[model samples]
Target: MSSDRRDFVLTAGKLLVLTAPAAAYLEAVETGKAEEPAYKMAEHYWGMIVDVDKCIGCGNCVRACKTENDVPVEPYFFRTWVERYHVAEGAEHPDVDSPDGGYSGFPEKYAAGDGAKSFFVPKLCNQCAHSPCTQVCPVGATFESPDGAVLVDKSYCLGCRYCVQACPYGCRFIDPRTKTVDKCNLCYHRITKGLTTACCESCPTGARQLVDLKDPKDPVHDFLRDHKIQVLKPQLATGAKVYYNGLDGSVR
Candidate 1:
């Protein structure tokens, strides 16, 4: 007998001895269908690549993140955001502003030949391997997943705001409704199902890319090998996974 026929016969024979649910199993076996394999966290080491020169300050990433994650619409709450930086020709620090967490596109503030070079920098959770937020969570509510995403357990959170204060990148925020600290998880729900992040999907300029460092075939390896990359707040030694290309020195 063919494999399908053999499977069907074996399943049918067992049906007489098994429970009603076996009927469903038999049908699946006969059709050569099986459940999707569970996602293996160990198989992936997730990260992100942001190309600064390609970011256009359009706020698409911010909008997509809020829409996908149901983050509070208030200006104070954001899973991801963008900042506009103005580096004056002789200024000591770059003038940085992110109005309403860049939910809306930025307005033109500098005129032509203002002697200030302006650019957009998109920001999100660094998914650090050695995240301070995880260390400061006294209740063990916040943690780094095996796949390199930083996640929070709302049920275990004490709402003490320790993690929020510990985050050097200003990425963590208290979800007012949940009364717990929340931050980006790199869209864990979508990524586990083989989908890219909402921010990456929405970026028109292809500035953002989701990467799997463990996958030898993933393009992130080639990109990293070829480009000069930097991460936010490297001095803190957070082991941040978000890599930036063409990062300016003036950026904080």
Candidate 2:
């Protein structure tokens, strides 16, 4: 192990008791055997591009995320979910719902030619550069990673739920198993290994795509320059990294 890695492990161990999996991960890193141990965090500024128009409400992404991250099966606890927005003609606000966090495909609620325009909006952690969750976390367990994903160290988390309340996007939830605040980290484990997120991988229509903002050759640059993309709740100015194309104004 490098001196820095050893020091980090030692410091982290001192802060809290490491779980078996966490301990094994530390051991792997010390031995230079961890998955993608050599990943250069500094080289990547991670984000995501969500093509709003392409999402078909298939619920494939939600199911894939749950399977990949082991999210709680119960309703209202999700690392990622999809919401269906129905805007009645001439209505100011849209009626939004996510049945089972959209784990199962949405049922047909509105009849054809009902004068309601409905669309599916997939939701996850914004991965904000100025994240309120990190600020509100008293124990420093919730933090933004160097590579731009907001993450939580479960061992250090106090399960206080402060971060959950501070989040503007309602993306966080308390894990039933661990009793800790949890949200999407953009599949940090897979991304560090140069693989796409499970949600992105499962989307048959390619609605979600993992992006590296700092890479000059990355196609995200072209997409951003060519398309008029917007972040959810841009008025809050959270510096959210996730960009949505073809987003409707009525979405919340």
Candidate 3:
């Protein structure tokens, strides 16, 4: 095998070994041999590649996510949201807005002769390998899955807000209705059932594409191996799973 392929297999093997105990425990529970609760084994590593160049800021994704997740109407608990970054050439200040929590049906405004262009960036939990939210959760409410997805056990959350503060991206938030900390799980429910996430499915421009990195034949895995990709806040060493292709320099 090629060196790259060998390295990938080695890494995958290590991850499998690390998750063996959890898998066994979950199997026992599923068979009624244990009383403890555990997440079901994920056979694939979920990944998303967003092409910022194709994003149109249509807000369809935001609306779909809210409706699918049954998010509260007031103080919206957005599983995904968009950020508008306006940068002017040689200007000291730039305007930022997420009108109507990013569900506003309107075009973005741009200044005339602006030195730099403005763009809308969609934001969500990165589901990092070294997730700050999971590490700081005193009650083990937040956790990282073997497939690199970050999740929360809402029942175990103590509402301490430690995870919220620990997240540098400001993705986690306390749900007003549940009073528990919440963030994106990458639509775990839909994914496990072999369905696309509501947000991804609703995207009109097809800017969001979900793939399983575990399968070498998958387009996303091939793309990541062959092309350049950028991760959000990579300097923080979070090992984020979500990657952006054709990302703007101002997207950080």
lDDT by residue for model 2 (30-91), tens: 98776556789899999999999999999999999999999988887888899999999899
Ten contiguous residues with the weakest lDDT in model 2 = 31-40
Tell me the spans in candidate 1 whose CA falls farther than 4 Å from its real position.
1-36
Could you tell me which residue pairs clash in candidate 2? none
TM-scores for all candidates? 0.86, 0.86, 0.79
- lDDT of each structure? 0.93, 0.92, 0.80
Whose TM-score is higher: candidate 1's or candidate 3's?
1
Off by over 4 Å in 2: 1-36
How does model 3 score by TM-score?
Answer: 0.79
TM-score of 2: 0.86
**Backbone-clash count (model 1):** 0
lDDT, model 2: 0.92
Ranking by lDDT: 1, 2, 3
Whole-model lDDT for model 1 versus the true structure?
0.93
